[model samples]
Target: MDPFIEINAIRKGLADGEYSSAEITKFYLDRAKKLNSQLNSFISFCEEQAIEQAKNADNKIAEGSSGPITGIPLAHKDIFCTKGITTTCGSRMLENFVAPYDATVVERLNKAGAVTIGKANMDEFAMGSSNENSYFGNTSNPWDTDRVPGGSSGGSAAAVAAGMIPIATGTDTGGSIRQPAAFCGISGLKPTYGRVSRYGMIAFASSLDQAGVLGRSVADICLLLSQFGGPDVLDSTSHPIPDNWLSSNPKLNPTKPEAKITIGLPREYFDQTPNLKSVEIAMRVFENAGCILKEVSLPSTESAIPAYYIIAGAEASTNLSRYDGVRFGYRCQDPESLSDLYQRSRNEGFGKEVKRRILTGTYALSVGYYDAYYLKAQKIRRLIQQDFLEVFNKVDLILCPTSPGVAFKKGALSENPVEMYKQDIFTIPSSLAGLPAMSIPCGFQNNLPIGMQLIAPHFAERKLIEWGHYFQSLTDWHKKVPELS
Candidate 1:
């Protein structure tokens, strides 16, 4: 069995009886178990449950009732609740927590017959950029084990890159999905905000958190999205699925787009270091495809980092208040009073980075500082959104580097929090605007992968897929994989 087999090929093989779902499931399960020690990509394995699901999928295939994703193996980020599976969210607070109900993303995928192999490790409470904040330990990049796999979706990206699974579910509160995908050399999508249901997924920053996928290619992501992307009654924020979003054949090759398609290059994003030269070289593919490239301005780009941190921190503080040790999560032993219990439990259970954000958030939302900080940040958020909306009026899509540079060493930015936050400078603006964005491997830098980002207008995911698929067809970047021993 080929570890890098495409999702469509897997589907065809299962339908033709070339192989059984049980066989493929076991193959990936064994591969994951073998590599997890070196990479630390998964927190827990669902071996027995995965095998059982594979058998059930085989039964469905025999009955001719299998769906598109039926029998396909996938891993879920630990932030999502999986019934009977431990959902640690990469924090000690939920280390022993087992969800009683499946997250909407998990439920939808299960109904499509995809088997859950395990829960991928992530930054504690989805807080870090380098995956070092994970309570379970950092996830190593498959390309270079000494380096970091970008976080908070680092495990998902690394696992997919190493071919442990064809695809995995990820959430992007800021650049969580795209950054890791770029660092690990895979395709990742952060859909338009509210495009996918978030119910039962642990909250990071409510308004900014969006569920997406990391995969080997855009086609694979489209196949999975067709199954799970849609409005859900449980999540009020979920958007209605566009009528034409899912076509009959999800893997159909996209036709050449009309010549009038225009992509914007924000001057602010382009004024960076030499590593972005790879992204500039990649722009020619679009030119050769007859698409127009226009230089545009997004002046608010400088303010994005500060604004994003403030907004995300404020929301994280409010959302995390539930884990006070008085309720369901980690509780301190033998507390004399409720206050002591709350203080000790949180101080001991939460990680350094998570505690930092909580403290910053609390201060921002405090009585004397609400308007001085949080309110001002919200006003800046509006400006950032307006900047994207203005640029969209002049172009159909925006192009930029996904990160300032390629993946760095594990401890490189751990001590310098400000420098670490700048790693997301390119990805943050699009996220703040609630637009659909994707990261695809474009070229290699110093033996590491370089990723270019594509941003489309709200709900314009199909456009991104079309352009991204076309780019992959021209370049072998996405096809290149690390030679893991």
Candidate 2:
């Protein structure tokens, strides 16, 4: 089996008998074991279970009952609860917790015949912009080990980037999926908030968190979405779709030469970014892609950062309060009483960034300050959504750099929290709006990958995927693998 085979190619190989699912699974398992120490991409590896699942897929293949992803190997971010597997959520609080049932994303993918080989690492409680905040350890960029893989889906992105896995599951709350995809030079999509099921996935911010995919190309995301894109009764947040939802999307015809689409470039991104060299280079790829590029404005974009933090923090505080010492997570030693237990357990369990956000959120949600901070932020969030809604009406999709600049040195932004927050300026507004956004490798700058982001209107992932696939067809940016030694 070719180690760098794309996910779709792997599926084709399985059907054509070129390679068995077991062989492919073993190849990835070996690579994950070999490079995990270097990249710290996986919190736990499930070699035995994955092999069994692969064997099952082979039986299904032999019986001619296999589906699109029936035999593919994938990694799930540790935030999704995997039955009988330790789901740490990259935090010490849940370090010892093993979920009794599978998350909806895990269950749906498993039913689609995909094999999960391991649990990818992430930022602690999905709080940080960098994977350095993980209790396990930071996941390093496969392109350059000294540089950080953007979080909290960094491990998933790193694994896919290194050819250790052809595809992986990720959760996006803010820029977790897209930012890391940009950093690692892979393709990732943060689908609309409720398009995919959230049941069984650990909650961060209920309104902001959404499960998505990261892969070697846009085509992989399309395939995965077809398999798992519908509703789940277990997850009330998942939208109910018509029975023919799969066939309802307009087919993407990338081969047509005269197929020109309108792409909007937000003035806020161009005006606010400190450096735009890499972004400028990436937009050139868009120019020659038969797009009618037009300048647009999302006036509330600057307020997205502050608004996102307030809402995310408030929701996180509420969701995370369940991790009291009485629950099934880490409890502090020698607690004198209930108060001591709650205080010490949280104090001892959480990382610095997680603690900081919790405090900020607690204050924002407090009685006197709730109307001033949380309420106002929600209003600003509505304004941000309105800005996107208005611009999207005029353009088929929006394009911009996934990050303000290329990947920075590890630990550089650790001391400057505000600068670290700004790292998400380009990616957060879409998240706030519950829109579908994608990150594809656009070019390289200073030896690091530059990611171009494509955002579509709510439930318009088909458009984003169509544009992404068409863009990837015209350029080899998505095909450039990091030369990790």
Candidate achieving the largest lDDT: 1
List runs of model 1 lying over 4 Å from the truth.
Answer: 241-243, 247-249
Q: Write the per-residue lDDT of candidate 2 for residues 1-485, one digit (tens) a residue.
A: 56767877897899999999999999999989899989999999998999999999999999999988898999999999999999999999999999999998899889989999999999998877779899999899988899998988999999999999999999999999999999999999999989989999899999999999999998888877777777889988888973244434334556633467788999988886666665666567667766788999999988999998899989988898998978689999999999999999999988888887888899999989999999999999999999999998899889888988777789989987778988999889999999999999888877788898899998887778877887778788888887767
Candidate lDDT values, in order? 0.92, 0.88
What are the RMSD figures for all models against the true structure?
1.1, 1.8
Distance (Å) between predicted and true CA of 200, model 1?
A: 0.6
Given candidate 1, what's the lDDT at residue 230?
81
Report the error of model 1 at residue 278, Å. Answer: 1.8
Off by over 4 Å in 2: 242-253, 274-285
